[model samples]
Target: MKNVIKTIGIWLYILGCLVVGSVFAQDVHFTQYTATPVYVNPAMSGFHGSNYRAGANFRTQWNAVSTGNTYRTFNMFADFALGKPTYYSNYAGIGINFYSDQAGDLNYSTNKVDLNVAYHFILDNKGTNSISAGIQSGFGMRSIDLTNAVFANQGGGFDPLGGETINRERYAMFDVGMGFLWSYSPNKDRSYYLGTAMHHLNQPELSQFTSIGVSDRMYAKFSVIGGMQVPVGERMHLQPSFIVNRQGPSTEINLSTLVSYSFNREPFDKNSIAFGMMYRGPLDAIALLTRVNLETLAIGFSYDVNISSLSSASRSNGGPEISLVYVGKPKNRGSERYCIPF
Candidate 1:
């Protein structure tokens, strides 16, 4: 009886997602928006403290809702800057991003790959302020497995598999996005930035079925992201960030604050510990985040505590995410005058 109840609840959750998808046509997202910089803004392609950057992220959600019925996502990116290393010189950036998401009992999945480019404009002689514009192009594929789907008319009762034909299992589409950003860094201990991005500008078709009356077009999404870094002391700093996203009829907002303490006085030494909290509004969840930095490598972890109406179904279990990042210069290269840790 417990198993049957869990199965029914899982189906209900899946049904809800499908209904919402059909109406709002929203996209999958990460709570840790800053961890996936390129996904948030193409202008962030190579906007780190180092000349090159690489990172990976993974998230899993709703494990307590039902066994074997959950959502998982994985993402990876790499980016680098072009031209000579000088604070007063302009440069270009290029990057690649890839991600995959799997959801529900049907094992529905989406895979995407994107290429991004950006140009940076130096706004001051000291290079303390700059602007950037970026563009991205991508392709994505969506698929679902229907072999285990249950139908109402199968065997004249509730059947796990029916005789109905499932003609389409996958679909592919192309997508594009653009962004603009402005950054200011007075010194190594303080920085601020704001950016906006628009995605799915083409609204490409997403339906696998070629039949009439099917209008499964991807909806356009817009985002606003901003953050600042403040030095609390010689070995401590504070960071506050926010992100707002809107797609079709749905919207989400996250606000966060973090504090980091460095073990060494040198800003570039990179030995530090950071911890923070975030709130997702409309009462979604409260997230706790922590990270450790070791020279050129950093590792981060976060967990969400659900606090919304869905907590009844989710059992307040929410989700957990992990991320790894690396930033470095070439073997013969030295550090630059301007650095942005994010």
Candidate 2:
């Protein structure tokens, strides 16, 4: 019975691929710049401070597009500095993240896990130039639940090479990645970061069909992020940021600017709020900004009002998005350590 179930599952996986290849629809992605971090690059694992962090994101695109095609993802990571050049200059840390995405009944879905480790090196006495190298390994599973999907055509009506209706099946696969990060800062507490990462270096086979097909040949991506605080007056400051992403034949860019203020309270508390717009070119079009925040705690949301030609049919409800982030450490709060850089 176990073997029979496995065989059925394999067949379902193949069917899912066929459906996916035929649909050729794009995913509903979020406009929030920080949610899809790891998908952008593995080096992002250590991009934050020497602390652990975690996040999740979900997108519903083309409301007019079938609900089955909506996209959802969840991610989490942890990093920390190690050694002691002066005080933990020999920085090192490890992180893990997971994500699952599905589109339409073509049943194209991926559940992946990543393990990463990185080390930071100081290249100058000025503390402005630093470099980090990181490696990542992980496995993924893809499958289709054909039993619940609504096929384009009734299966009973078809006959030819194979049966019209296939059940559900899943496959487990593995991949590896490596990345490099270069960072610099002209002043204290401000940074400019650049990184590159290559995913699917292992190029694992994903086909469960008799003919054996393959996944995307490979994914090479590059990213650049920079931010600085500008004095706006006595108690207010402005921060601007930009992020660019590329994968295989697709590319995207995100731009944002945030303004913040500081209080004269003890420990010098600080607060900030940011809003910016994004132009995803022909793919996605909209502007978004985040809500205000207190030190170590941040909450923000974004919405993408589609302006594409499809807008006419989508009721101007193209796609809406929301994101929430919390960063901070618990004081005298047990043995758990969090990466909440305020």
Q: Report lDDT per candidate.
A: 0.79, 0.54
TM-score to native of every candidate shown: 0.89, 0.73
Query: Model 1 over residues 1-342: C-alpha lDDT tens digits?
Result: 655754564456446545744643577777777788987899888777557889999999888775676889899999988765467777888889999988877777889999999988888888789999999999988888765555433433444421222234677879999999999999978888999999999998765443423356788999999998888998888989999988877788999888989998645338988899999977989999988889888888999999989899999978999998888855343436555556
Cα lDDT of candidate 2 equals 0.54
The collision pairs in model 1 are none
Root mean square deviation (Cα) for candidate 2: 6.7
* Candidate 1 CA-lDDT value: 0.79
Q: 4, model 2: CA deviation in Å?
A: 28
Which sections of candidate 1 miss by over 4 Å? 1-20, 156-167, 330-335
RMSD of each: 4.9, 6.7
The prediction achieving the highest TM-score against the true structure is 1
